[model samples]
Target chain A: DVKVTQSSRYLVKRTGEKVFLECVQDMDHENMFWYRQDPGLGLRLIYFSYDVKMKEKGDIPEGYSVSREKKERFSLILESASTNQTSMYLCASSPSGTGIGQPQHFGDGTRLSIL
Target chain B: LAKTTQPISMDSYEGQEVNITCSHNNIATNDYITWYQQFPSQGPRFIIQGYKTKVTNEVASLFIPADRKSSTLSLPRVSLSDTAVYYCPLAGGGSTLGRLYFGRGTQLTVWP
Candidate 1:
């Protein structure tokens, strides 16, 4: 089975602080993604990495950045956390860059709270 | 990415079949339809995927028409614990590397 693990399940940070959410997959998948889920707004993509050192902005990438220095690890960075940034952050991974039917395997998710 | 449309919410009782439909008018030929189920405070779990026709797994079944414009997810004899938010992701053609576009999912509530 493909297993994706996040660094934290619940996190709390103060305003203007830096936050880092980590995700690791054991399936050697080439794709990884970060998203924030809010009530009524749904899950919005923040960033996605196709390969090492390659990143792309999604619909809502503001105030968020991603790092994929290695194939198995993807990190989401919040440079200056704010109350608005508090959300349920999700991480997912899939095996190749060019398959339409591959279902993404997700981590447990991290609920971040900014005060 | 193709945008998808689904119901805002649905209600069903245990031991009854549940069907949820998602509409994707601009779906491409190479695109695939996938569904995920998410519980409160947890990440979404993959339910089923299909390009066309019908595909069935232990958990659910996916039915796609010839036009591939819309798809239906069928849950058999659902249990109370089967309640969750179901998201229909319109995956792009070619590869899975494309970022999935998630709309407001359909929240399913199962009653006893």
Candidate 2:
């Protein structure tokens, strides 16, 4: 079984603070994705990395960035957290090839609250 | 990625089969249909994927017709644990790479 672990399950941060959410996967998959889930918006992609040090902006990457220093770890950084940033953050990984058709494994998710 | 439309919610009883259908009228030829189940406060879990015809897994079954415009996810004899949101996303090949559009999924509630 594949395991994707998020660094925190529940997080709280003040406005204007820089927040970091970390995720690590055990299966060594080449594709990692970050998404934020809001009430009516569903799961909107924030960022994704197909290789180490390579990242692409997703549909909603306005205030967020990602880092993939190693194959097993992907981190999402909130440059300046705001109350609007409070939402559930999810991380997922999938094997290489076939692009969007490949099955992805996901972590439990990190519930972030920006006050 | 093609936009998918599914029911907002469904109600079912235990020991009964639940079929959730998603419509993707603009699905490309190379696009594959994928289903995901997400529990409250958890990330979406991949259930099944199929291009056409039928594909069955331990968790669920995916049925896609020849036109490839829609797909149905069948969960057999569901329990309370099977209650979750089911998302049907069309995943295409090539440079799109790991990008999926998850619309508001069908929320299924299984009762005892």
Candidate 3:
């Protein structure tokens, strides 16, 4: 089974603080993604990495960035945390850039609270 | 990603079969219909995927019509643990890297 592990399960940060959320996958998948889930709106993509050092913006990328220094790790960075940034963050990894009918396995998720 | 429409919520009882339908009127020929189940406070878990006709797995069965405009996910004999938010991620095709877009899912509650 594919294992995607997020650095923190629950996190709290103050406004204007820079926060970092990390994700690591043991499956050596080439594609990693970061998404924020909100009530009623569902999960929206924030950023995704296709390969090491390559990143792309998703639908909701404002105030967020990503890092993929290695194949197994992908990190989401919140430039300045705000109360509105509080959400459930999810990390997912797929086997390849174009995984035919393959699913993106996700981590348990990190509940981030910005005060 | 194709737009998908599903029931906002559904309710079922233990030992009863639950069928959730999702409509994707604009689904492309190459698009694959996939379902994911998410428990409270957890990320979505992959359920099943299918192109057309019927596909059955140990977890669930996927039924697609010839028009491919809609799909049905059938859970046999659901229990309380089967309660969750079910999402249909009609995946984008080809070199786009199969990125999936999720809409407001169908919340399914199972009672004993």
State each model's CA lDDT, in order: 0.91, 0.91, 0.92
TM-score of 1: 0.96
Best by TM-score: 3
User: Candidate 2 lDDT, tens digit per residue, A29-98?
Assistant: 9999999999877899999999999999998999999999999999999999999999999999998876
Supply DockQ values for each candidate.
0.67, 0.67, 0.67
* Candidates sorted on lDDT, descending: 3, 2, 1
TM per candidate comes to 0.96, 0.96, 0.97
Model 3 docking category: medium
Residue runs of model 2 more than 4 Å from their true location after superposition = A99-101
For model 3, how does the per-residue alpha-carbon lDDT over B7-68 read when each residue is reduced to its tens digit? 99999999999999999999988888899999997889999998889999999999999999
Native-referenced Cα lDDT, model 2: 0.91
**Could you give the fnat of all candidates in order?**
0.69, 0.68, 0.58
Kindly give the stretch of ten consecutive residues in candidate 2 chain A with the minimal lDDT sum: A95-104
Clash statistics: count for each candidate: 4, 0, 0
Residues A20-90, candidate 1: write the lDDT tens digits.
99999999888899999999988999999988998988889999998999999999999999899999999
Candidate 3 ranges with C-alpha deviation above 4 Å: A97-101
